[model samples]
Target: MSFARNFIGLGGLLSLAAQAQGAYTIQDTYDATNFFDGFEFFNYPDPTLGFVQYVDAVTANATGLAGYANDGIYLGVDYETQNPAAGRASVRLVSKQSYTRGLIITDIAHMPAPVCGSWPAFWTVGPNWPHSGEIDIIEGVNLQDSTSVTLHTASGCSFSQDSWSPQDCGTPGDGSQGCGASTDNTQTFGAGFNEIGGGVYALQWTSDALRVFFFPRGSVPADIDAGNPDPSTWGNPTASFSGGNCDIDSNFANHQIIFDTTFCGVWAGRVFGDDPTCAAKATSCEEYVGNNPADFQDVYWLVNYVKVFGEDGGFKRSIAKPFNA
Candidate 1:
């Protein structure tokens, strides 16, 4: 049930129709001044049980873990103290609003560098875990130089590979493994991403499919710069998840955007034995993260802005909801 035969290039006429209909409209804008207003800190225990202490807004700002910096919102982690009682202090933010479908654009100036024992992500998830769905937009663990874009759902969803990479979003053997694709662009993730001053990541989610595109700093589309982004002109996406095997509308709904940096969690810790460079630093991922605070100095996120646009003026303002953090 590969989607290769059904795949539609982003630059094709279908996208042109979306633009011609002027279906997209600015729905929300999150930036330094208003970012905190629209997002809440999650201080609860990590769902993945990462070795991290999710701090509150007060603790985050007081400890310099989260604040405004370089004309953008800065979310960072503790890198000075070693072996904290609970774990290394960090910040995890979730958007107050939830949406079913839209265009999400995030302009980032910097991301956590590809350091050992760190797992950072910019993602969205619906309620009830895999039953609803999860989209990993920008994610990597422990020294990964490229991003892994993935989708986690209950079952049935499958995808085909684009021309850029080999990893395909085929149906998972077990629902827990999910489906994913990897990017080969050196500057699309990790230390190289920060070295080039970061860039924009655009995610377009619709009933038909979920597509993600990445543009380095110098190559960002002019429409994006002018605040009139049109996916029709964006060409092929870095990754696309779609086909007859899945019902996107049924698997995903009311998703909230999120950003966080955790230390030695399931993904990073489980894979530590495979990376020689990291293995030499400590016997285990948790041990290294607990002992080597200095190594995580670059664990932070500098976000320029996050804009959400909805189709046909269907966007709605979300009411504040209590979240465990």
Candidate 2:
């Protein structure tokens, strides 16, 4: 309960048109006063089949599961039960509005611990999914050393990055292991991320490629902290996905931001037994996660704010009392 809350209704719209000039203007800001106003809770079943009980915003707020925490937006889960039938209680959120091409940056204060059976992600996806494209800005499964930036697209899409693997951004079920890259910086995600008080994760979507950048808490760029992000001056990106044979524009459109944490899903569950440390915990991913509720107390996201910049940005018109007169 050490957080602030505001009941102010959502107001205004900001121009977020993309420009080729590389200069971006402030389009929108989702901070403590308006974080929940900007994004909506996703109570739908887990698409990745993770052991999770996604709850509505009403339930979230009422149950102390999602709310403000220490000046940041905190999304947490249930850790008191010893194997509930409905799965671990958690929260999933998606932006109310969608975007096509632009700069999305978020300042996070804490992320879920990189413990066994835990999967957390902050990403964006096109309205049509694979047909449009999916960008994994911050994502990793169970005990991963670091998060990975991946781009999943329809058939015939791939990128050129030094450390990326498989070189195939194919659609789902193509036997291709996704096209993405990861860094050795453990501080970029999980336990290491929370140690330094989290950091900033930014994604730039353009007609040619989708790129991701990470700036640890103290190393954040002056331009970004100033609300004027210039990726050009931010140096080389952490990961960049430029399509070789794919039409980036036609393949990706109207993307909505997302944040979620699931347990023992497709990735985490499938590889559970393969990990020596995790495997030693239990016979299966479900067994470990279901029995150990106390281990997940640190499973949460505390975000300071999320900002969007565009070629020509302007603030949304604020309204008061609905002006029925």
Candidate 3:
């Protein structure tokens, strides 16, 4: 991959943090030499211990699926729980903080998306109910052509269709549980995102609004190119998940990052089965994997890395390893 250099001033940094950061320059590249000397996977204060479980029985006992270069963790899904025709694969992560400024960028390098029944997602959630909040930056089920983004906040936070996209996107209520409940049409997000090498879904947050951006592999912004936290250069972007409309930011403080692969259960399983159009093509969850068993060999997400970046003016930025020095 070729590299480039970009400049990010204070305004550009704040804009990119709220919108899309600048293109990734070579300086942001992730080198194996500088792994996790200073970084720590966030462990949220919420009661839940964040982890990725497999639908297959055998692998689930192994804890996290696999690690690429020992950087980010992998998550697998079982055959029995997977409904391929439904086009839903399960993945979830919970933040460690109650309410601090943070960003999660996942390098989803090698993953299985070409097959059927692959539903992958990158998102966040709060401690309590809808009052806390849930942000789904990339979510799609059952043969979807594009990806979808949503925010689930109580009455406090909501979203608005900025000048970027003319669509009348509504800020979902707490009951819908944000994107978890909002059944958005999958085909609208474009074909590139659902394809191979997948893409990067960034969930940027603060006490204000939560925004999301999806970057295909080669096109990941320059600010994140070096693979550390630098939310200064990304440019103005059309796709975003703002929490300002509904008061969504207050419920979450210390957020944890979760990466898991789940099979058919509630969303991808039951919901697709009920859809009139997709039901005809949907087969029994059993027929999908035979006994690959959630206990054994299942689907997994091979992540390149999981990075955390702070917002424009909220928290202090700390670096574990200096790529340039």
TM-score against native, each model: 0.88, 0.88, 0.59
Runs of candidate 3 with Cα error greater than 4 angstroms are 1-64, 67-72, 79-99, 111-118, 163-174, 177-196, 227-232, 242-245, 274-278, 281-298, 316-325
- Give model 2 RMSD, 1 decimal: 5.7
RMSD of each candidate? 9.5, 5.7, 10.5
Q: Which digits, one per residue and each the tens of the lDDT, describe model 1 over residues 100-151? A: 8789999999999888889999998877767778899999999899999888
Q: Flag the better candidate by lDDT, 1 or 2.
A: 1
Could you tell me the TM-score of candidate 3?
0.59
> Model 1: runs farther than 4 Å from truth?
1-21, 160-175, 313-317
Q: Output the TM-score of candidate 1.
A: 0.88
**lDDT tens digits, residue span 1-325, model 2:** 1235432333324333433434776666787777777677888778888888998888888777788767678888888889978889999888766777878999999888877899999987765457767888998988997888877777777665444555667734542256778799898999899888889999887777677899998999998887778998988888877636768887777777788899998888999888999999999998998999999988888888888776554212222111110
lDDT of each: 0.80, 0.78, 0.42
- Candidate 2 matches the true fold with a TM-score of 0.88
Clashes counted in candidate 1 amount to 3
Span of 10 residues, lowest total lDDT, candidate 3: 7-16
lDDT value for model 3: 0.42
